[model samples]
Target: MKNLSLTPFFILLCLSFVKAQEVDISGKWTGNSYFLGTQIFTEYELHQEGNSVIGFGTTKNGSDSSKFRLVGEIKGQKIFLKGVEYVYKVGKGCLSKAEFTYSNSGSMATINGRWKGTMELTTCPPGVAGRVDLFHKKELMVAEPVAQSGTSPQMLQSIHKDDFEGTELVNALADRKYYALIIAVEDYNSPDIQDLDNPAHDAVSLSKTLNEHYTFEKENTLLLHNPNRSEIITAFDELASKVKERDNLLIFYAGHGIWDERLQQGFWLPSDATLDSKAQWLSNSTIRDYVGGIDSKHTLLITDACFSGSIFKERAVFNNSKAILEMYKLPSRRAMTSGALKTVPDKSVFIQYLNKNLARNTHPLLSAEQLFQSFKVAVINNSPNGQVPQYGPIGQVGDEGGDFIFLKRGSR
Candidate 1:
């Protein structure tokens, strides 16, 4: 997509800048290469003749491994290489090209670049490309797991990556387990308030979609239907206590919302909420507090309700085409609402498009902003009243401009 390159992401490596006739890219390079959203541990043994470069490297994912040859040149500050013909991977004839910018923090040289995966082979993962970040072998902080090299074939086909040990599961730039809090209130106790139809049904649909295709697991996802105010608060409290700083959190709500003009406040009506009393209603500010309190790398709140847009403080901005690695570096608190202080229908066009898009995405990493951009305009055009969906940073929620990344299953 756009002008960026794509790579099959099967093979690649790194190294130290040795002293030579030119800026040398020789020696053993060790680091991580992100391809197809999988973090492949790589090592390169390279030799340079003037500006020309030649190398062979190995990439390991979970227990899978493969070898390939590299050929490229030193072009000023960037090194360009093509990983062609997977020697051990069974694939023949393809170019997994990468352009890396060379930099040094003191004596520690680092190369980071984008990949362009050309499908010359029979099988090439299309859609989105990944990033490669390598440091000199000296910069490696921990040792990666190495199989007997015979397990590559079977490892490549396995859906689970539990074979990778230690904290590799929590690598911010790679794959990790995602936690979710799903709250949907369809049956309100108040006779004065009209009951809704899609909240519980939509929640079930979303929960299944997330657990089946994305990084979210059944154990990690908490679902509550027709929950009262206390139960809703308890769920947040439990997540705040359990979620670690490196993990990500997604909170989804499908229910009725009200905007009080006199008080300038927005509230989510719980199952126990009465029309005459505001005590049982959940305020947007309280939700904000919980969002900010959770020690997660990224927190994305998806609300399908009237006046749900009140959570947003200012418009969020991030280049969709930016490297996924770059986006994962910071922390974020963001929300995507059904509408901006406007009444939405019981049958939502918002959640409809959201589900369709999530299931259809083929890329390894899908960011929150990317997900919203895919369906916001469509929902507006298709809605009966032309409801405008809102997306932005949640106010005072410690948003450091990071985005919530949805890692599709089997990517790692």
Candidate 2:
């Protein structure tokens, strides 16, 4: 007996039968897919015109969820779809290539195929393949649109100004000042506390960028190099006292950080911190308390140290509305970190992209979320060890779904 289970000519055979039926693959498509022998749920809203097919989809594998933009072409009775971009992802996600064969039994229409992932797109999972079994949801009313607006809300969450709807939202911060507290701990007094090469230099670079390009003035931006635990708290206290309720505050930290798994806490090591004890280490909870004490309308915390992402707890991330100005209306406590609960490099690829984006940005009122998302993908792709950057609202820190807006010097 000869085994003809499947061959490379499968796609060719599907194409021959595809011409028998007219293809109109539009509207909702929901089904199951497999990768690494594990089953995953997928939902797509597709539109097909002529031979071109375009859509967006949400896929879930257990607790992990990701939204991807789809682009494909209809081949006779078959469709070849590829994930071009990841609009949103909860964890490590990569682009996918899928080929589906559409078949109708007069009562129901189903598409079956196989999907593969791009290993280089994201780390870990390497690359794998599995089967795709999808059924079209046939609820006809001429045009079956995904949303009231043609675009999905997933795309709207993107930080680009051009992607937003309506005019810019007005920010009444003309009388207010943008205060920045930059703390970079590079030189450690204790041998136990590892010294970093880039924090001090990074602090200077960021201060210059803020003063020259953004609304933050030189006098308003305070730089602290090799600050002890006391000095760090003193800096926050000063900001709390000096900053007005309408003012905005930006806190930037770059140095060695660690997560105390036993205590379920995270800390930033000051220059004087010792390995024997966490006495001189700055606790994230303490920082959160200090951040809450500040009356600033918006607070943006940028951390470029290891395990910096631990600042957020049950967080709500950036989701841009129709107008840009809506970002600054409510008081917010937002954090932008280099990577999630992982050790980052000393030289700092995160800060490099961050500064580059800030310098090149011409937008008069750029939100902190916009700045972070613009270079997030680049940081992930360019990082040597595939570090995943994080951005979200800090818990119990007076965050009201607003964001810190970076005003360009001459744009306004």
Candidate 3:
């Protein structure tokens, strides 16, 4: 040995070994998993002994359930699990053998991986194949592929102004599901009405924000651009069919709205609507009926079009903050409009202010009522045209004096 210094070499080897060692993944974790473009709420409870691990988990989608019985081994920072996911279909038990492999995300607290399975059920005819992208429950609960900004408690406090009260109750929105139908009709068949400048772009921007910040499911969000009357109705019907009582439904329309003085009602002009045919325009009452039929716990209609205030029957009275959990259980129907039965500028001051506030809102939970108040204030203060935003309950609809809850990501 020619003056071999063993210290540095020994430390390097030890560090390499430590780095390659498997992390301890033993705990309860809850997160969302995506399969076929739908978000599924998932939970895991695992117990590890030595390198071997055993666990059971449950996945929920509305009323449907998928239970898993798992056995796995942790090997060099990766976990390999083999399990049978028992799912109920047509009142019978259907089982699928699944394999999941999760690699440590440089932290023992979290892991993520892909899950694949094949089903050969007794009740069904052919075998089915399925694959899902899943992840360990992260402290910051936002959409994936986008890193969390990790706003601290101090930052949250600093951002919340005194005007918006009851922000401490924001965590109540965590368990609720958000569904949105965003419609923007910039192009129209009639040449006399003129084309819009920003509705389609605005709709897309809103949809992206909803997914990135609010955890809206990809499948549940309907982004309709320049859609005709039938298409609009079909979109609403589809959303109504899938929504559940634990969910919140948002219907946003950015287009031309006509106030029929003779009928004392408002109509949303679709892409195919012509000046000659009033029948082609979709009535607010018809839209209300479609929204009221949904099983969602809360429904909000946001319109940037002209005469948008015609959507609400009356102004909402109960704006105070109650127990958020109990508040979520109550039904609500609300609307926020750009202007009170007047023509708003096509540039969209309403959505601009609304987006800015919502993106910066630090409250753990923000109610629709609070959101509307902010919109009203901002639009009145900023807009040169003085387009007064309106907010209230949909008349004769299911307005139960309850407000819709919006969860701020990582608020908990």
| Alpha carbon lDDT at 121, candidate 3 | 41
Q: Candidate 1: lDDT over CA atoms?
A: 0.77
TM-score of 3: 0.60
Q: Please report how far candidate 3 places residue 93 from its true position, in Å.
A: 21
lDDT of candidate 2 at residue 154, scale 0 to 100: 22
As a whole number from 0 to 100, the lDDT of residue 410 in candidate 1 is 62
Query: How many residue pairs clash in all the candidates, one count each?
Result: 5, 1, 2
Error of 2 at 45 (Å): 42
lDDT of 3 by residue, 145-226 (tens): 4445884333443223221123323422455578899999999888878999999988988887777666577887889989
Clash count for candidate 1 is 5
Clashing pairs in 3: 170-364, 170-365
In model 2, which regions exceed 4 Å deviation? 1-171, 315-322
Q: Mind giving the per-residue lDDT tens digits that candidate 2 earns over 262-349?
A: 9988899998899889889899999999999998888999999999989999534555552455566677998999988889999889
Which is the better candidate, 1 or 2, if ranked by lDDT? Answer: 2
* Winner of 1 and 2 under TM-score: 1
Highest-TM-score candidate:
1
Best by lDDT: 2
